[model samples]
Target: MKLLFFVPLLVVALVASTFAQQASWRPVDTKILSPWAAEIDPANPHPEYPRPQMTREDWVNLNGLWNYALAPKGAGMPEAYAGEILVPFAIESALSGVGKTVGKDQELWYFREIEIDRSLRREKLLLHFGAVDWEAEVFVNGQSVGTHQGGYDPFYFDISEALQSGKTQSLAIRVWDPTDEGPQPRGKQVNEPRGIWYTPVTGIWQTVWLEAVPEHHIRSLKNTPDFDNKQIRVQADVAGATAGQRLRIRLLADGTPVGEQLVANQEEAVFMLDAPQVWSPENPFLYDLEVALMDGKKVVDQVNGYTALRKISTARDANGIQRMLLNNEFVFQYGPLDQGWWPDGLYTAPTEEALLFDIEKTLDMGFNMIRKHVKVEPARWYYHCDRMGVLVWQDMPSGDMGNRWESRPGVIGKGTEKDRTPESEAIFRKEWKAIMDANYNFPSIVVWVPFNEAWGQFDTEEIVEWTVDYDPSRLVNGASGGNYTLKGQIMDMHNYPDPVMPDPQIWGDQQVIVLGEYGGLGLPVDGHTWQEKDNWGYQSFKNETELQERYSRLIQDLKPLIPKGLSAAIYTQTTDVEVEVNGLMTYDREVIKFDPAFLRNKHQELYTIKIPMK
Candidate 1:
């Protein structure tokens, strides 16, 4: 009788388990994945620390699989979920294990379980999200905590009070992204993926995690290296400083003490160094830092960080024309027009190694700078550039691109600017400021590009003036390949198939002339393209030999512009994206069409010519 009773119960249990698996599981779609994607453990995705500038030893990564459902945009909450989708990967991406699209009228929902240690519960619990697309509303144990409304910047919430009883608690997130239908800064994302426009990234496209901190902690840090003075200015933003709390900062160079500073109540201090190592592409050096909040001598909170000492400015070259100077020297900046995207993960790379791959490959291609076009990458991407010694020209992603763009070379043309709605303008300004503040610590970024090719360009004069005044430490390219704005330092132009400059005879006297984009030579290899048909490039080639020969000729043609007051040049791209097959490598990153040695030898000859002052 006992055996018979247990047998039926076991059968029921087995059937239930099978049904659950069938409802909540799906295989990853057929797409090109990096080697790192194969190594991803769904139990713990993105295990590495997300914030390189401010890091704590005690934290938990909340990536991995979560219960997910797609519902109407106005839907409050679904009592039941549809399936499971991978966190940190967009719902529309193949790596999410659910290659489904959520349109403008729908909202994506996520549910997961979280646990907190009883001992650590005494301290304040904070939830941190590296990023979420468009807008996100977070909840803890059935209670709403907060809502964040930015697709690119990081935001957090204090969910300590919302935690229910027991070690385990419920966590939920709701996300909505309108892609191109909205007037927000959506970058290149579009509901209908086509040439140059990519599939929309919706919900948690970056690492999500938790941290336990004391009542008083270091909320943020700003480290600015004054190269001329041999000192580093430090500012700490304390979250909960009591009456007698203080802040201390210690600077180190490879474990050796270089300088230290302490301030009472006030959060500003300067550390004068003995011998500062100048950071550059050839010899990239970083100084280690330890920041602490203390009650007299008792340590309250501590964090680890690092910074680089370098300078980027604009000055007249040997000629009377304006030129960009790096570390007080005139070196022509050459790099690819990098559009940050992936086949499997969309906006998110499969892994940290995959994130570093492009920078490493760019360095291998003998390029010192990268014009990061129309999109902001994860913080780790810039961290790699800082450590690897590659400079960056970061662009504010374009949206509401209704402006009439005029690309008439040799003619100074100011394109008709877009008239953004009050709400849309507010959204752009808020997000742009947040993006700048979040990335100000990284030393690799030398230029901040406000507009690109007149896409969503507006209020050129005022916006350019505001950008220049906001961050005088870095050079501002107000409009790259866009209108001929009389603000900012560089006059940039974009030309296809061949190298071209911004008419040195016109804008050379006041601003630096540069070819912001050019040379999109394309050769699509079979089995490596995103689609079988309709794949295109700015200039198509029949074979590897033709592509290589044409590429070398373009570089040879580019060198003569340097003597004519051209300060820099950017090639079309680092990898193929979507239907655009104008990359040095394939979309899958599986093939490099040209020989590296041949390309490097050709690029080296461009730098050998000396620039003499007039």
Candidate 2:
């Protein structure tokens, strides 16, 4: 990862200012105003524990400011330094302190210094990036440590060997992201921001930190809840350990130990509670977990975690119609279409508090569910959802569509569908499997959406079956909006500016009716928009009163459809993106747009109405 180069001092100073300008060193009008906003001290911002699910009291927080520079395509390391840009925000975002675009050609370089604690000399130190858009190369004190690709997944590298004692450790990173120009699994990020698409997020857009662990440490763990069997399956993947290492796992409920077991390296163990407490929106009970690596009688490494009890499946209701069952009963689902975006940070939130605020607002809006559209959030996000009692329907991020012409909409209602190439199909399948494997343990995620609006959609039947086989405990939405084959459990439809119900005849016997997306009421408040002109929505209104009136009307229209078998409905979105102004909240999350009281009343009305099975 080492790059050798030289740059004139004048050129370095010029580039430093340019980087700072692009990173939005001057605050914009649309910046989110929170109580904690002014307290973001570069020295101690986001000091809260990063991983809520797997808690370790001994770990350190390595967030805050970092030195940054933008290099031209194929440029080597610069001799001089650039100004400081906030760590974890993309260069294209306002919060990054650099709002410049990192195109397919250029590379974004980041350099930071960290002082290692003197007491942890014998421990192995690992550098972790929650996520870096596309690809990243790491260097520790001028020595190459590792490199990683894939934008939505977390990766780490052990840099203990590259460290020197009694000196500040210098960490350097080089990132290259093609975004929409490449065939990577980037969700909705495009070089040119447009309707429903967003500005490209390049370089580190998530938390970056360093952790010190023993030679034999807990690498990863998975918790799967089986409500029907009344057992939880726990799998541990220990790293830097010997083959015969024994790991002890203890399951606790309300701080009381329920079950304990010992397993060998990289093995799965089942722990049964005396009386399992099933997880649901009404009662979200999580069992505290503690796992320790042992060498005979001594504990080598330990980590704390938690798990919830829940079950998701399709079963016959009292009226014999297929419905989504949670904890063995039918519960109508309703939520917003969450497209994880921020005006300041783009992919990353300004801080962990900001991230939690979005989830909290979604719950406060009186909805119990959310369709996580195409983007995978950090583990902490899902942990918040689990703790806040919000159900999640996770979607696999779409891939490249080789035949763009065939995928584009032709007439007002007609569309072209083409057969996918074998290579494209194989790639899609591989990535989809990886996504499911990575997020399978979360109890809040009940449904797996394989395709959305027919993006790279092929072999629908096969993919749906594959999803079921990969994780049979959850429901499957074969296709979210269009090109439905009636293969999945939910018969989902999409309508904008108005609500629509699926044709019962096409989904009469097997599927439960659900409005996957509808009601995009947009109002772009001045000074809070990404761009002034061409700010569009599915249905735009001039003022908050009009938006609220239209929203209430839409809900009133959906009332009769409940009796006609509408089981669930997800409104257009939670917040607006770059040019798409249709959001309940503004892009910066500064304004709620509509009256909260009216919206909450409408939400309560929607939830209270019982759908007839017939």
Best candidate, TM-score-wise? 1
Model 2 residue runs over 4 Å out of place are 1-37, 240-244, 318-320, 402-434, 486-488, 611-614
Q: What local lDDT score does residue 496 receive in model 1, on the 0 to 100 scale? A: 82
Could you tell me the lDDT of residue 607 within candidate 2? 73
Lowest summed lDDT across 10 adjacent residues in model 1 is found at 1-10
TM-score of 1: 0.94
lDDT of 2 at 467: 82
Give the alpha carbon lDDT tens digit for every residue of 293-372 in model 2: 99989999989999988988776544565667788766878899998987666777667788888888887778889999
- Model 2 weakest lDDT span, ten residues long: 405-414
For model 2, state the Cα shift of residue 320 in Å.
4.2
Residues 1-614 of candidate 1: C-alpha lDDT, one tens digit per residue: 00112233443355345435554443365455544555556777778899998899878899989999999998798899988888899999887988899978999999999788876577788999998998999999989999988898998998889987899999999998888999889899998888888889999999999989887888998888788788887788889788788888888898998888887645667887777888898888999889989898999999999887888887776667888888878878999999889888889888887888888888877888999998888898988999999989999988988888788654544779999999888998988998899999999999999999989999988888898898877888888888879798888888887887777766888888888888888888766688887899999998888898899789888888888888889999999998889988887676777666676787777677677644
RMSD in Å for model 1: 7.9
lDDT for 71 in candidate 2 is 83
